[model samples]
Target chain A: MELYIGGISQGKLTYVCNKKNISKDSDLICDGAGCTMEELLSKPFVNHFHLFIGRLLKEGGAIVTDGAIAPDGPKTDSDRHFLLKPGHAPDPEKIANVLAKDLIAENPSVVIICNEVGCGIVPVDRTDRLYRETVGRCLCRLAEYSQVVERIVCGLGMRLK
Target chain B: MIILITGGSGSGKSEYAENLAVKLGKRDLLYIATMIPRDGESMQRVARHQKRRKSEGFHTLECHTDLKRLPVHGFPTVLLECMSNLLANEMFSEEGIIKTRGNIPVVEEILEGIAYLDRLCEHVIIVSNEVFSDNGSPYAETAGYIKLLGEINCRIAGLASCVYEVVCGIPVCQKGSGIL
Candidate 1:
């Protein structure tokens, strides 16, 4: 896994495109927010890795299986996974662990674009704090599992690992 | 030359900035603290920082809100403690004073203040918290603060001779390779 991280609109996508010479038309590009692990794997390429955390939080802190797909949402798996934006989960750690394993099983490499979010002050709201920590922990897991990690600032890429 | 140092809370950016200030000084260095320790927690934070810098020979200047009219002294090296607090101070004034103004004027004031600081100090080492990266939605006003902080960070990165992101007690130079 190759992880590209930076703030929103900090040019992580542009940097990835230029570096890998990826053509958007040919490559399967999709926003990972509220997307499933299967949906993510279905696509060869992906960005907004931080949104995966959001999706996980939405899924009651777990990545629902193909059979256990969300009911209120579509079961076609066309592009649907979770519901909540940021909610208190049953067990976030278990969710993180399960998805982490699935992500490591991919045959080809995948580029995960994460938004950095742990540098600011702790939010007063409990839900906000949980979301921040969830994203932060997810990024740390991805970073450890990733072969290459880059932090982009102002459209420039810095190799972190 | 300008050096922009950033890090998360408890990431040791202050220590790194202080060391950089000491090394880059051509005259007595100025420590422009932007934080206003109104509450007890903040007051303790300030006291800890002061104790750390006590033997460093810095002439501290507590300029919380207004950086434009900073007493003009040709200090070769000056470290602005942080931009986040400074921005909050300028954005939301003291309680019961006046209605909190819009972000446009606050951003303008901050930009003007920074330019003035740039002119007064030869080597400006700016310290700022990384605010915009959080994943959750902030309050409407807080969201505005995040936007402005990002703009200022981008602008300053262009002007800075060096930029460092300190993480886990290490300084990672993001821009301007030399003179870290």
Candidate 2:
């Protein structure tokens, strides 16, 4: 696996296309913004991988913090009761690890392009904090599994690993 | 020598900076902390940093604002923990924003403070945040803070003999040498 990361609009996708000798609209590419998990696993290149995590979090996949399921909306008695269940709440870090494993297992040779989001000011919203934290952890795992990791700046790739 | 170290939150910039300081300095090492613990979260952060600095042979000094007025002086090597919180404290006064006082601007005041430390210390290792890369906030105050921090980082980098942007516990030298 290979990973390419940078800030928004730093031409990360363009750099990847040039490096891979492929076009932007090539069928080998998949956008995590709207692509399904199957498409992401099948494609050779995945862009906006952080957004996929964001979407999943919004869909109530893994927004857990402190071993408690953070409510995305109004909580009822059943929600409270569910919170009482032992060993049922999912951890964001564990979720990231599972996602990373899935990505590496299903698409071993995939190249990922994700935005650097954990650098900015701490978000006031709990979900935003969880999303960025989860994305950072996921990227860490992917980078560890990746053979080559580069940080993109102004259309230039700086090899980090 | 003025060294500016920058990286994102939880990117291990602090550990990198501390190690660099230990490598560069001879004996007297000063850690100037700028964050003011106003709540539990920030207090936890402060404690985490303190734990990391234990046995690192650093004499810490908490200077939340008015860095120019710091009394202690003459250290062989001085490490300022961060520039973002200091900049925010300077920029955002209780009355919204303080762009200028009399003639000196906020940036200049802060820079002057840095220059004071530079003049006094042999090696000044300044730690700053890489907060400019993310999707920016919609608030005007946030935009203003970002712009100011960008200016400060650029200025410091220009003066710095070494500038490092750390990522994933790895220090990537942006300018100068000796940090490899």
Candidate 3:
């Protein structure tokens, strides 16, 4: 497995395409924003891998968005860990761990392009918090299983492993 | 020697910094904690960090804001837990209002605090967050905070003898010969 990670719009996908000698519009590249789990496993490359984790969390009912935040919410830490529906949702962290294991077992040679999302301020919404934390855990597992890992910055790739 | 360590949360930056501090220090080790526990979650975080360094013989000083005024007893190595919390504490006062003078003063105050630590300690290890990467539509004040932190990190990196961005428990040296 190969992993490429960086901030949003840091040119990770472009760097990967150039290095792998793959066209930008190749059918083998699957976008995590819309692709299914089966497609992800079968595809050679996955972009926006963080979104995939969010989708998974949403599907698993770990993300509850209704009545969570006001349209323009008051920016305060009061809502930091306030669950919208307590004891009614599946644990996102466990789901994320299982998904990570599945991905490593199902597709060991896939190339992943994920945005680094855990660096920002802690989100007031519960869903956002779970999404970022799950993404971080998922990427850590993937990076460990990856044969090579690279961090892209300003369209430049820095080999990490 | 000033070493700036930065990374996303859960990237193992704290663990890496602690290991480096332990490796560099001889007898005296000081951990300057900047986070103010507001709730259970933050308190848990603080406890977790303390548990990690339980046997390291670290004398921790809780300096949330006004780092410049915090007195240090001059340790061999001083590890400032993080810059993000310290900056937040300075940017937002106890009443939750933004400081009137803007972020320049905050940056200067933090850098001055860092300089004080540098003068007092032989090795000043600083931990900061990589908060600039995430794509969040933040409010104006939040944006200002981000901008301020980015500037502070850059200035510290410039002055740092070594800088490392910890990724997945691995320290990727960005500048200077990091403690190998």
Candidate 4:
């Protein structure tokens, strides 16, 4: 089954990925990075995973990881892991299609990291509002593809298995 | 009251804001001008704005990048003319240059300062140019700055009770009714 992890805290994901034996693979296709969607899709890979931290992940065909922001506290763990992502919108689907093709072709268990972009007040600017909507749609698409979904609040993880 | 007026270059936002301040009969209007006297044309623009405000007898506060240090004497209206320029000044400032990429602490500090000013003022009007309008792809740094500026502008606009989008010298208020 595909596993997705996301949250606003980078440290948490790094820790989890390390524990789960997921590190930067030369074969990994990372469309969520600043690279163009075309570049990510074109890259050859067996299993594709997208990692999103403080930002939104809009690319398709992968399980989504939830990386919501942490609430007020020291670096210590708490129950706020289910915090939502920050930001307004998602990247275009055309870009996401590139990444989706790679993940589906390989049929490997793909994990995605995405920020919950809708946890804040709605923005007044059109572009800002559009961003939030885009991110939300991206997450929805990712959830549709995933066999399981999970949310992290504070430091606790609840699996939608 | 505190208002921030921001817009892209040549959007005529500053001119509209000047007119609005006058219509409000705020003789002691605190115009927090951000543009510096860089070149002759820029100098002239600053002078013209100063002259127009002076002719109408409006008080002005000229600040470079240090909004935190500006004296806040409880002005009824404070107009933060343009945030992009302020951000540019702060980002390229001697100390600002030392901060590395993705190090958003400085920008956060500035946002916090703006939020503080907004809370302290009675009635604030903010003006900002829409930098995302029809411009082709910009350099990476420029694009990053614009995105960051847009984020800050949206946050501030969210707090504003009134928001206006000035198009072709016309003010379209997106929120709140009544003219300034």
Highest lDDT: give the candidate number. Answer: 2
Return whichever of 2 and 4 wins on TM-score.
Answer: 2
Residue A16 of model 1 has an lDDT of 83
Worst lDDT run of 10 residues, candidate 4 chain A, spans A65-74
Report the lDDT tens digits of candidate 3 across residue range B82-101. Answer: 99888888778672214655
| DockQ-derived CAPRI band for the predicted complex in model 4 | incorrect
Model 1 chain A lowest lDDT segment of ten:
A81-90
* Cα lDDT tens digits for candidate 2, B71-151: 657678989989998888777654212644544577887889889988888899999988876677899989888888989
> Lowest-lDDT window of 10 residues in candidate 1 chain B?
B95-104
Q: How much native contact recovery, as a fraction, does model 1 achieve?
A: 0.24
Q: Judge the docking of candidate 3 as incorrect, acceptable, medium or high.
A: acceptable
For model 2, residues A1-161, the per-residue Cα lDDT tens digits are: 99999888999999999999999999999998888777777889999999988876665533333333332421444443332234343344565777787788889999999998889976886567667767877887787789999999999999999
Off by over 4 Å in 4: A1-161, B1-8, B95-106, B135-138
- TM-score of the second chain in each model? 0.90, 0.92, 0.93, 0.84
- C-alpha TM-score for every candidate: 0.55, 0.72, 0.77, 0.48
| lDDT (Cα, tens digit) per residue for candidate 3, span A1-161 | 99999888889999999999999899989998888777777798999998877765554422223322121222343332233245443344354557667778788889999998888876877678767766876777777788898999999998998
lDDT per residue for candidate 4 within A50-109, as digits (tens), equals 333213222222223232222222133222221223432233332234334444554435
Q: What is the DockQ of each candidate?
A: 0.12, 0.29, 0.29, 0.01
